[model samples]
Target: MSEQELKLHVPAVARRAVQQDIRQGNASRIRLRALYFDTPGRELARARIALRLRQEGRDWVQTLKMPGADAITRVEINHARPGPVLDLSVYAGTEVEAPLSAIKGELGLCYETDVQRLLRQVRSRHGTIELAYDTGVLRAGTLELPISELEFELMSGRPAAIFAVARRWQQRHGLVLDARSKSERGDALASLARELAALDADDPDAQVRRGTAITRFWAPRGAAAVTLDDTLTPAQAMGRVAAECLDQVARNAAVLAEVDTLGVYPAGQSEHVHQLRVGMRRLRSAWRLFDGWTAPPPATVLQGVRTHFAAFGQSRDQDVLNETVTPVLLQAGMPVITFEAPPVDIDAQAIAAGKAFQGWLLDALEWSLDVQPPSPASAPEPMAASDTAPEPAFRLDGSATAPAITPTIIPLATEAKPQPLHKLLGNRLHRWHAKVAAQGKDFATLDIPARHDLRKRGKRLRYGLSFAESLLPKSRLRGYRKLLSEVQDRLGEINDLAMAKDYYQACVGTHPQAWFALGWISARLDKLIAEAQQAFDRLADTKPFWK
Candidate 1:
C-alpha cells in the first residue's frame, strides 16, 4: 500500500500546546519502540529503504518503506509480526522482494526510536486524515537524540487535504515542514557513532569520553543537484525538473523554518536561506524553459514563490557582506565599521513556514507531477500563398510520395501534437545563447541595475544549459561552461561590492568610518567590470554546445 503524509516539526515550546489540541479529538496514546535495521555496508539506507519492527504497545508490526511515484508518496508495506523476529519469507514474491534480495551483508539493528504517539483519525471535506504526534528519543549506542514531530497522513481522498491541515497546524502550533524521516535521521546517527568509535578506539578513557559526549542533531541540508533522463517526453521532463527543484526548496526551507531537534538553529542559517532562494530561482528558470509546452502551476503560485524569495533577500545581503566581503575589506587596511540589524525586523523563520508559501509549495508539487504522456506525431501546417515562393505542403522525411502539392492530398490537423522535445530544446538554447551574447556586448556601459539584471540573466542561462547537459554531449559543453563560470564569478564579486557600497554609504552620516570602506569598494568596481566584460565577450563568442 502507498501512504501520503505531510510531516512537520513542532517547536520545543509548543509541544505541550500541540498535545493539548490533539486531546480535543479524543486521541489514543500509544508507546512505540522501533528498531531500524540496515546492512553493515548500509545498503538499505543507500537505497532509501527502511526495514523495521515497531512495537505499538503490545503488538509487533514489521514494515518496509520505499519511495513512490511522486515526492509526497511512499510505498509502505506492513505485516503483523508474531514476535520480535523479522521474517523475510513473508515478503517473498512481493513487489519489494527484489530490492530486499539485493542486500549482500547481514542485517543488524543500527539505532532505536522510543516515541510516545498520540494519534487520532479526523474526517474532513477533503479526506480521512490521521493526526500523529510523536515525542521521543532516538538512541544509538550511548548517544541519544530528541524527536518531536506531527504527521498528517491521508487515509482517503485527495492529498491536498494533508497540506490544508498542515497549514492550520503550522500556523497554530508554529510547526515547520520537516523532510527527514526517523529512518534517515537514525541512519545518520548510527553512521556518526561508528565514525566516532573508530576515532577513539586507541585512546584511553574512550568509554568515559563517549558517555559524557552529547549527540547534536543537525537538520538535513539538501543539495541543489539535478539529473534528467534523456528519453523523457517534454512534459515529463518539465514536471520532473520542477519537482526536483521544489524538493530542494522545501528541504532548505524546512531547515530555516525550525531549529534542530535540540532547539538550536544550525550554524549556517543564512546558507539555508541562500539555498532556498537558489532553489526558487532554478524553478523559475525551468518555468521559462518549459513555457507554453505544457500546463504550469497557477500564476498565484509563481508569485508566492517570488514573494517569499524576496522576503529572504535582505537577510542574504547582510550575510554576504558580513560573512563574505567584510574580511576582504578588513585585510585591505579598511577602517573599523560595524554592521548590524535591529533584532525585531529579521525573520527567516516566519517567511519560510508561512501559510501562503507552504500552501503554494503543496499546490506546486501537484502541478509538477500532473504531466500527461507523450502525444502522437504532429502534422505540418498547410503552406500559405504569398508573393514569395510557397514551400511544398509535405517534406520527404517521413512520408513517401507526399512531396508536392496535389488536389487529393489530405491535410492533417495542426492542434494536439506535441513537438519533438529535442528540436524545441535546441532552438530555445540557441535563442537564449544569442540573447545573452547580444546583451553582454556592452556590459560596462550598462547602469548598476542593468548590470544586476545581466548578472541574473547569466545565472538563468547557465542553469538552462546545465539542465540540457544530459540531453547533449558532455564533451561539447566543457569549454563554454568554464568561460561562463569565470564570468559568473567576476559578476558575483561586482554585485557583492555594489551591495557593500550601499550598506556603508547608508552609515556615512552617523559613522565617519563608513567613508573609507565606501571609497575602497568604489575604487574596485570599474576594474572588476572591465575584467567581467572581457569574460562575457569570450563566453558570447563560444559556440552553443547543443549544436
Candidate 2:
C-alpha cells in the first residue's frame, strides 16, 4: 500500500513542547523499539529498500518500505506476528522480492531505534491527519544519535491538510521540514562507522579524497529533486519552478554549511558562497514572478531571507575586492595604501544565516504546495494601457527626461483563467524585452543608479526565462541566455568599479592609501561605462527568443 506523510525535524529542546501540545488533544502515547536489517554489504539500502521489525506493546510487526513518487509518499508492506523473525514470504510479489530473496540469509541487524511516540488525529477542512511525534535515540553498535521528529500522515483526506497543520506548528514552534528517513540516517551512520574502522586498520599510505571528512556533517541528501513537467499548466509550472528553486537553495545551503565547517576555501575561491547566492537570487526571482498568484510567507520570513542574502553579499563583496579589484589596481601602476578584508568569522555568520534561510525556504515550499490556484472568475485583470508607456529616460545626474518611445502592451494572465503557460511566458518575456530595450536606448546617458536598475532588469529577465526554458526551443534559449549573461557581466563590472570608488572614498579618513586607488578606478570607470553601454545595446538589438 502507498502511505502519504510529511516528516519534520524537531529540535531536542522543542520535543517536549510538541509532545505537550499533542497531549492536550486526543493523543495516545506508545513506546516503540524498531530493529532495522540490512545485508552485510547493505544490498537493501543500495536498492532504497528498508526492512524493520518493530515492537509495539506486546506485538511484533515486520515492515518493509521504499520510496514512492516523492519524498512525502512511500510504498509500505507490513506483517504482524507473535515474534520478530525474518519473513521472506511477505515480499512475494513486490518489487523488493528479488532483492530480499537474494539477501535473505545475509540480512542482519544494522541499527535500532527506541522512540516514545505520541499519536493524534486532527480533523480539518481538507481532511483527517494523523500526527505522530517521536523522540528517542538511534543506535548502531556503540554509536548513538538523538532522534526527534513529527510526522503528519494523511489518514482520510486531501494532502493539503497535512501542510495546513504543519504550517500552524511551524508558525508556533519553528519546526523544520526534513526529508530523511530513519533507515537512511541509520545506514549512513553505520557506513561511516565502518569506514572509520577500516581507515584505522589500513596502511598509512592510503589516500583520502578531499572534503570527504565533512560529508557526514552536512544535511542528508533529500529525495530526488523536483523537475518541471512540460505538460503542466501555468500555475503548475510556477509551482514546479518554486520547488526547483527551493531544492537549489537547500542543496547549496548544505554545501555552504559543509564549507564553513571545514574552512577549506580561501578568499575568492568559495564556490559554495557563489552557488548559495545564485540559489537565493533564483528563489527571489521566482517569488517576484508569482508573488500575487501564490500565497507569500510572512513579511518577517521574507525579511529574514533578505538579511541572509545581504550577509553573504557582504562577504562576497570583500572577496572580490581583495582578489579581483586589488590586482587590477596594482597592475595599473597604482599604489594601494590599504585594503581591508571582511572579518574572518564572515563565513561562519553566512552559514548560520543560510541555515535560517533554508528553514524559511522549506516552510515556504510547504505553504506553496497547499496554495489554491485562482479560478477564472477571481483572476486578476491585465495591465493597464497607460502602464505600457515607455519610462522616461534619465541623465547621468539621475534627472528624468521626456519619454521618447512607447512600449507595446503585454497582456498578463489573470487568476480567473490564466492563458496557456507558453503564451503567458512569451508575453512576460516580451514585457521584459520592452523594458530592457527602452532602458538601453540611452544607456550612455544613464547614471550609476539607472544602470544598476537596468542590470537588475536584465537579471530578472534572465531568471524568468529560465522558468520557461524547458518549454522553449533549446538552441534559441541558449543563445538568449548567453546574450543576457554578457550584458549582466558588463553591468556587473561597472557596478563593481562604482562600488570600489565608493569604498575608496569611505576609506580616505582611515587609510592613507585610498588616493591612488581612487584615481585608478576613476580612470577605469569611463571605459567600463562604455563597455556596459555597448553590451546593453547588443542585448537590445538581439531578437527576443519568445518571438
Candidate 3:
C-alpha cells in the first residue's frame, strides 16, 4: 500500500495542548515496541529500505517501507503473525525479495523504539485524517533520545486539506515540520552513537553531552554545475536558471536553520534572516523571468514560500526597530513611547518556517528536474519592447563609450530547435537595461509609484544579470553589479524613510511622543529624494555588462 502522510515535531511541553485539541471522541491508546534491523554497514538504510518488527497486543507485525514516487508518499508492506520472528518468505515475489534475501543473514537489530501511540480519526472539510501521537524513547545501546511527534495520515482527502490542517496547527502552536521518519532518525542516532563510542575509546575521560546540542559547522549543498556550450538551447538555459535558483533557496534555508539551532547572535543581529529573504526574492525573480519556459510550481508551494518570507521579514523589521531606529531616536533625545513589538521567539519561528520552505524547495527541485525541454515550435514568444529605440552608447559622466566587444548573436537553426542561450540572454538583458534607463530618465519628476516601479525594474535587471553572471565578462560584470547596488541602496533608503515616517505618523496621534521622530524624518525626505535621483542617473549612465 502507498501511504501519504505529514509528520510534525511537537515539543514535549506542548504535548498536552495538542492532545487536548484532538480529544473530542473516544481514542484508542496502545503500546508499540518496534525493533529495526540492518546490516553492519547499514546496506538497507543506504538503499532507502526500512525493516521493522512491532508488537501490538498479542500480535506482531513486520513492516517494510521504501521511498515512493514523491517525498510525502511511501510504499509500505506489512506482515502480521501471532509471534515475532524473521520472515523472508513473505517477500518471495515482491521488489524487496532480491535485496532482503541477499542481506538477510547479515541483518541484526540496530535500534528500538518504545512508544505509547494514540490513534484517532478527525474529519475535515475534504475528508478524514488519521491522527497519531507517539511519545517515548528511541534507544540505541546506551544512547536514548525522546520522540514526541504528531503524524497526520491522509485516509481519504486531497493532499491540500492535510497541508491546510498542518498550517493551522503550526500557526496556533510552534510545531516544526520534520520529514525524517522514525527509522531515519534512528539510523542517524545509531551512527552518532558509534562515532561517540569511537571517541570515548580514544579518550576514556572525554566528556559527551546529550540532547540537542548546537551544531558548530554546517556546509550546505551547492547547485549543480552548469557549463554552457555552443549547443546549449534557450530552453536548456531556462532549466539551468531554475535549477540554480532552487539550489540557492535550499542552501540559504539550511544556513537559516543552522543559525536558529545554534542561537548565535549578538543582541539583535539577524544576518541569516536577511540573506534568506534575499534568496527568496532572487528565486521569485528567476521564476518571473522564465515563467512560460516550463510548468510552474504548485500554487501552495509558492504561497508557502511567501508566507515564510513574510514571517522572516516581520522578525527582521522588529530587529531593525530595536537595534537601529530605537537607538537613533534615543540619541536624538526623542521619547519613543508606545513602541510595542510582538513577544516572539524569532529564532524558533524562523527555524520552523525555514524547514517548511526548504521542504517546498526540495519538491520544486524534483519537479524541475522532471520537466522535459520544450521544442522550438513551442518556444516562448519574444518579449515586447517600447517603440522608442534605446541610446546607442552609455556615458559615465559627459563622455559616451561603446561596448568594447559586442556579443555574438546566434540565429535559430530551425523551428525544431530552440534559439541559442547566449542570444536569448543577451536580448533579455538589453531589454531590461533599456527599461531601467528610460524609467530613470525622469527620476526626479516621477511620482512615488513610478519610482518604485523603476526600483523593481532595476532589481529585476540585477537579479537577471546575477543568474547569467557566468556568461558575462568578469571585469564588466563587477562594475555593472556595483553600480546597480548603489542605485538600489539609495532607492531603498528613500523607501525606508517614507515607511518610517508613515509608521511614526500613525503612532504619534495615539502616543504624541513620536511627533519628534516624524518631524525629523520629514525634514530629510527631500534630501533623500535628491540623492536617489543622482544614484539613478549614475545607473542610467552605466552600460549593460552583457554587451
Ranking by lDDT: 1, 2, 3
TM-score of each: 0.83, 0.66, 0.53
What is the alpha-carbon lDDT for the whole of candidate 3? 0.70
Report lDDT per candidate. 0.80, 0.72, 0.70
lDDT of predicted model 2 = 0.72
Maximum-lDDT candidate? 1
Question: Model 2 reaches what TM-score against the true structure?
Answer: 0.66
Superior by TM-score: candidate 2 or candidate 3: 2
Model 1 misplaced stretches (Cα beyond 4 Å): 199-222, 262-268, 338-344, 371-417, 506-516
- By TM-score, highest first, what's the ranking? 1, 2, 3
TM-score: the better of candidates 1 and 3: 1
In model 1, which range of ten residues has the least summed lDDT?
211-220
- Candidate 3, residues 1-547, lDDT tens digits: the string is 9997877667655679888876766678889999999987989998899999999866799999998754467999999966779686899999888877767448889999999888888778977788898888899877776787888888998765566566666556556565568998788768767666656445535554322121222233333444454475545555566666555554455444432233443211265566656767766776766566655666765786788778768766566666666677778888857556668856733453444654565455545544444433666666555533445676768677764654669897765565566666767788888888888878889888998888888888888777777777878888878878888887876777676777778886688888888877776678777877787788778776575
Cα RMSD to native, each candidate?
8.4, 12.6, 15.2
Off by over 4 Å in 2: 19-75, 81-114, 120-129, 138-145, 156-164, 171-174, 183-212, 215-226, 248-280, 287-363, 377-420, 430-434, 437-445, 489-497, 515-547
